[model samples]
Target: MTETVAAIVAAHRAGTVSPAETVARSFARIRAHDDPAIFISLRDEKEAVAEAEALGARKDARHLPLLGVPVGVKDNIDALGLATTAACPAFSYMPSHDATAVARLRAAGAIVVGKTNLDQFATGLVGVRSPYGIPKNPLRGDLIPGGSSTGSGIAVSAGLVPLALGTDTAGSGRVPAMLNNIVGLKPSLGLISTAGLVPACRTLDCVSVFSLTVDDAMTALTAIAGPDGADPYSRNRPLSEMTPFPANLRLGVPRSGQLIFFGDKASEKAYGDTLKRWTALGATLVEFDLEPFYETARLLYEGPWVAERYLVIRNLLASSPEAIHPVTREIIIAGARLSAADTFAALYRLQALRKIAERAFAHIDAVVLPTAPTVYSTAQVLANPLELNSRLGTYTNFVNLLDLCGLALPAAMRPDGAPFGITLLAPAGHDAQLASIGRVFHADTKLPMGARGLPQAPLAPLSANVAAEEIAIAVVGAHLSGMALNGELKGFGGRLLEATSTAPDYRLYALETTPPKPGMLRVQAGSGSSIELEIWALPAAAFGKFVAAIPPPLSIGTIRLADGRGVKGFLVEAADINGARDISAFSGWRAFVAEAAAG
Candidate 1:
């Protein structure tokens, strides 16, 4: 009914579709489509219609975004009166509150359609882990529809809804998106609150969005993302300082040799073709080692983290294990054997891998890789459950574990007609950067929305997350670009925004030092001249680390900017300047150093 949320709102304003009519259309479509597997529990249409009517009765309701746009929910998320089955009967419980992400969507004027199917307790990517019949892949019914987010994907693909909420742990959000050829936005973990959703892997879970287009995904994310105090891992890293999608961008490709295809020739060829398309988009391609990433992924399953899953549902498994799907039961039961020491060992190795991962950002803005090595037929997935599920996550499992945010979008189709896709990933809290770049890639490819043949519409450029939760800190000399301590700022997640001059009340002094450094001192009012400096947005969580990296002579203090914005910038302690030489006349350290060499 609402192929376009914005369009629907416009139409409603133009008197083309009333809120009641929109609700009716959704009800008609659900019955007309008649796919029971698509919804595990249905919301009463009469009640939904009544709510829509009330929305229509409101004055100035036309101003509401996503007005009358009906959406579906994955069963694991809470919605009043809906049984939170999590695709396992034993895990079912009716919740009294909407999940944080769901509450945000509803507040945006989207109506709830129903709760869709998922892999039991959201533990697989193959969709078949559910005791409920696997939702048929709309693109290829015989193939697996993908999991955890399974029914959310199918609902969008089948045109039953324009958007849906799904939980992504490992590849729940992404795998289904790839298989169904829709957009799956796995936000930085905890960017959108997970408060009312059942936990899968608590620390790694993210409430994800599935939509027909990049713009819709962005709109949905902007509405949903914010700090939720209830979620321990929730964070607010305002995208305020991030550069918008660059006109000329650099994309990192996981080195080809490291890619896993699992013997699917068609998928391998399709991926190679996508890489060629990347070149055509004028993106610089750089290859990087992905072993450390894969090493981190293997630990998620090959280690004791499964214990976290068991810890969440130990009682259910103990009391009613038979109620879980056979495959899901098998998977969860494996967790009981791990000792606490195993969890500790995995944590240590993960930290070492984390250091290795930091190296990737130096080479490129985001990393692109196949979303899934290959997708399998429903029968194939069922026959070899664990193996097939693992293959589908070849590129995904490492993402959440490594604290990265990812977006999966459809790419080329395999020769046999199965969908193949790729995910663009960045470190945690970089969701906006990844989404901006993703919009470029999504629009560039010209793929259809869901399984419908409506050519993908252009995204109104992503509003940069410029309100990013980082403090704008300025560096005048030693900690400036290419300086000895530059990495310290970058390691703590500082991103340089611009190089410019400070206000007219600043002076630069060259300090005498073992490892040469310079200090910038703010002058008395109207006295010192403006000096050249660079501004970097330092993540608040990592500001302490950045500060610790600074030596004694330099300290952080307020400095007025040319724009009248007061920000954290470098300053020199009065006692450290006795032997220092003033270089304010040369403009900046680079200019001063260059002139000194000429002498």
Candidate 2:
């Protein structure tokens, strides 16, 4: 099999292989693998090959990021030719167009080979809730393949495709990654448009990626991430460039005696070993309270959020109750009984929990947790479905509720032959940060690519130098990644270059604006504390327009970095500081904003 996305693209571009050949090979592998449960519907090989041939004829084919790469999309997301079944036969529909995420992938030169199977309406984490047969777990025949991304995970791990798309609400994305020993990226909510997706939890769902490596997962993410007018929930969360692992990184760990392992000693030891590995990589472990996060996890199914799931298939439930899986129907039916007052009570508690989650990350770069508390056999989960499925979500259920992004990476194959993985999570828009650390950790493991035991490919190189047509600018306050007005920079086609702090000659002040923003002011050398800011590169053609749109009391100026490099950045007028509160002690706008939210 042509293993990684990078290798396949390189071969195609180098004339060693053709796009049509890659597409054909994917279908051949699918037939050879012979896993009926992996894909619910496959594209016509002749049509896909014809499309690939046309793609290769284009002059700009070499420039396409995923040129000729084969991908499998979850059944819930629409693909042009395939029927969107979402694992329920009676609820199937032929979409007029591809889902926004699928459209982006096709635009990036990827070929959609098929729609992978998933739990019915994406309602269960156990994978067996679907009417479709369960995808066989390649690692252990008796072990349950994690879901509702079961088929997507198996597709990548079985070497059928280098990349696949999955949907994540609760643990659908991350749990499957662990069970299959692949990379799963559950991106920030709305980072990828959900316009053509059948909603599981409309408010919390986002498209996810599955691949053999973190870099491969990122390649798929970069091609699809952006705001879409068709998706009201879509956000302009810019994907930043991955940087080398930073020195003195701080990682949050649950306080002692807080982890749940369901009496699986092998999994417990694997998690402990994972923590030790992080320490060896030069990270400082900071302990934090886990009760709040646990409480947030419980609210997903126990509260009104389940109503969102019910809302998606209410018509199907009313028209043909037996058409739905018994377990799925039982769970979603609870949503119908939720009252307005009950919804408000849960919403109020959720808001408070969100604040605590914000503070939880204030002192750490990212938090590491077991992707799943433990592993279960297909027989075990079948016998005790609800409890075991809920247990798998111990670390993942609260992510979307808290508006965070995550990367699930293979940690180790336990002595008992079960796969164990760890997930790195941070507030939304820190996807790049998690990737930076995750890539290094994954390479350190030197694990095989998937169940087939293909040797892991070398890490792909990312360019460190700025492009000639781009101008780099520093943003200190509202325009920092994941901040209130960060979309303004992204809207101008800006890409984050790096995150760094200013020289110890600046002060930050909170300006009294509609939505409070911070301003950075230059002072005498050594007179003030350093302030954190991100450097973003914009096409030189848009630089002038970006600068000219700046409102009064704030303007672009030359700001010096602590590393002795100077760049154009945001600064405040001296007169505006007269009535504003000095916030320089907080170091950066994000930290200050988080502290305020916590209060």
Candidate 3:
């Protein structure tokens, strides 16, 4: 019985064992396992031991959050003194610093034992394309550990670490989790900085979290996440604005006919039975056209995004092509086949498919589907590498391309004892909603954490952009639900509350200006009718920043609502009313804005 992360933390917190003991234990495990393929490099034990003592020696040592927690980082991420190979020896390099995500974790008191192996150039979904051997699935020994995050998944699933960081371009983070029976959280794109990461498909790439429990994954994510100005892709989204999932939530499932299981009867049956469980949990299952999603998925492999990979190591492939793994080299070369026109054509089609995807989400809070259509053995993945790897991405390829966040968790064991799992996908900013409902779905499955019976906590899906700290602010326009600049509220973790009318004392005005601002004036008693506005809960940490984001004329002030409750809502000074037009007759901001759009 190996100690799980929670167990180790509890022991250290209670002084039963020190951080040095934990690191020594981790080194002992690595030595006993002696799987060369599991990690590309292992850190020196003395350095880790010395660092552990220096930290634990402090009188106020408990302040460290992940204090003395040992973690494995994927080799693609640069850990100081560790070589980054991305599984290609020719491409290996030593970075002076750790990746931004890794740095944050270390700062919070997590020690990196070493860099684990990855698929060649982090290109293939199958975890075989490396000079080092593939890591076997920790759950099912004969099965392939999901790659390119293959080893990261295996290390954590094996209880080597409580957590690890993996990059998701085409389900690298999630696919491995499914095979190993763990939690893989691919947050909204741009949620984690890609600055120190070697790009997979730069635009679609996201740094993902892997843990045995959803709670652990969330804890790790909340610690490392936030905008990285260094990485152009990083977005400063809130973690507090995301609200709790309501009971009896609406879930969208692809029309059964649309699911592709790739000839795995066990997987198909496993998925179908899971849906029944979803229904039993008191939720509506909405059937959606998964064709558009499939279309977006196709673009990932067939489209120019492969060129993003080609962009990164063009020189390596051009100079020493022979050094590459045959399958990986073959796939990397495909980017050369794509022309600029082909790239633009794919982009054009993606835009059209995204519109249809919007309609898919309109009727459902989150969509449920397989993390992978099925699983494969290491030998099977090697025999027909291309086709088998492509099959693994059948359900996953669409997520980031469609600008969505996802969480992959084990559901139940397949009849063969291989793990089966599902992913819940939602729009970019709705990460919290997907997690809220996803926790329910995960809880119903009642599986053990990772591959062992560690008495896991029922997962509580973490809201990716929740603003748990801000005051709820009601805004009629510009900050209205799905309106332009609404990101301002989300930036500070503002959550949208119910939309209700204002007290009859307030009069509505559509401010006369370009881009159109709105103002509501409090009138004499009984002179004005109730107007509509949406309440947003903001995280306290983000309130000041949220206020600073508000532009001219509109300001936070006490506004009366229909229910006799007065909260902070948008108010405009009376002096701005001279040119403002009365849009009160149009009712709420939504109606006024829609009419304007139609006009």
Candidate 4:
């Protein structure tokens, strides 16, 4: 069975395996796989073993999250021993330091194996545009490896490495994962710094993760996600730890007749099956028009954003025009022809489209779409490179353009052996929400990992309590999940920890407010009904702001739960409940609201 990041770390901690052994195993696998196009450069096995030995000697080695795990970096990312080549040899250069994301992974005790191959300058979704030969799709020899993160995807899927970093501007990260039957996590833009990354589209590019499991992908994401002083685009957004799948999850599905499978009935059927699975798992499917998102996707290439891609390779285009791949050069050279007027027109249209996309999410937790419209063979894509590549980005191209985060999960292996996958997308800071739901959905599939059919390890246990950086707040009324004002808590980056009942000593009252609300008040022990509520963890900074926004009688106070745990929550002053009605018999706000709505 292929080792997962968690399994490797646990083995290292138990003294059953050493970092050096893992690093050596990774190299051995690389040689055994024998795919020269999978990596543009590799570190000496001895050098990596030495680094692993050094890491094991550190005092905190046992506590490191990814201790001794090997990671493959996309060639576009700068790693010490590997030259930064965006698959263009003439554009390669040695960096004085590791990229910020790479450095963070190392700090977490990951060993860098080598620089993986990519689409030239990350200019194409099809992995074949690299000057290096196309990486053989681990699942099928004839299929395109899906790129520009081709090598990174193949490395993880082939079990050459447990984790690898890919960069996504327009589906480069996700398209390949679907083709390879692996997990592809495209975190919020700027969550992982681009400081040491070769820019594809400076604004839209994000470092992505490829792993055998959604949990493994998330572990890698947390280790590398953060603000960086060196990266102007990096923001101080707090990444909430994933929680148990929440009840009442509403997933957006494209309106009927809007989905495009390019005549591939197998992919279309697989997607339908995936939606049915999501329904069986208790998610509510809501139909939304996907036209605006498609428009936004078109703007990515049809607009001025191509200028960002060209900006990176302009010097190379000027000095060694022939060195760039013909397909890549053809795509990027168009950037130079776009005028400022064209750029602004697109930006303005994109902003308007973003607003439309936002409205779609107002009722749904996330939009579920096929990772790619369909798969293509290397021969087919090579013959019709540009058009075929554009079709692959059907669902993915709009994500980064609207600043949304995405999680790609392998849904099923098609009848023809092609892998079909689904992606869950949400507004930027809701990465954990996608992960929370995605982990559940992926595990339920019970599919084998990657191309080798390795049995997936058991899902790792999630933290039942809040992290030190967060504060737990109990919501009893409108702030509950699926309630009237639940978006406010979500707006503050709150994550659902658990749905539980309060200790049997709180009295629930319907408050007199414009928008109906419920407030609980403390009573003598064993004298009141047990009021139901949800506990959510909000970032400490956001918690303070959320507390300050409490109006009049509703105030933040200690509320005890059925499990004897106490948390700060909404409470009403006794004096303010004079005109309020006692709703303690209803037990919960949702129940009372449902009863009222039925009338």
Candidate 2 minimal-lDDT segment of 10 residues:
457-466
Residue 314 lDDT in candidate 2: 91
Off by over 4 Å in 1: 239-244, 461-599
Residue-level lDDT tens digits of model 3 in 46-116: 99988888878877667666788899998888788788888888888899888899999888788899888
Alpha-carbon lDDT, every model? 0.82, 0.92, 0.82, 0.92
- Write the residue-wise lDDT of candidate 4 on 331-400 in tens digits: 9999999999999999899999999989999999999999998999999999999999999999999999
Error of 4 at 215 (Å): 1.0
Candidate 2 clashes between residue pairs 3 or more apart in a chain or in different chains? none
Q: Across residues 1-599, which tens digit of lDDT does each residue of candidate 2 receive?
A: 35899889888888899999999999999999888999999999999999999999999999899999999999999999899999999999999999999999999999999999999999888788877798789999899999998899999999899999999999899999999999999999999999999999999999999999998888899999999999999998888878878888999999999999989999999999989999999999999998999999999999999999999989889999999998899999999999999999999999999999999899999999999999999999999889889999999999999999999999999998899999999999999899999999999888887798888876654433367899989898888899888899999999887788888999999998877788888888999999988888899999999999888788888998875678899898788789888999999999999999999
Clash pairs (backbone) in predicted model 4: none
Q: TM-scores across all candidates?
A: 0.77, 0.79, 0.77, 0.80
Model 4 regions more than 4 Å off = 465-599
How far out, in Å, is residue 18 in model 1?
2.3
TM-score of decoy 1: 0.77
As a TM-score, model 4 comes out at: 0.80
| Tens-digit lDDT string for candidate 1 (79-133) | 8778899887767788988888888887878889899998888889988777777
- By the TM-score metric, which is better: model 2 or model 4? 4
Between candidates 2 and 3, the lDDT winner: 2
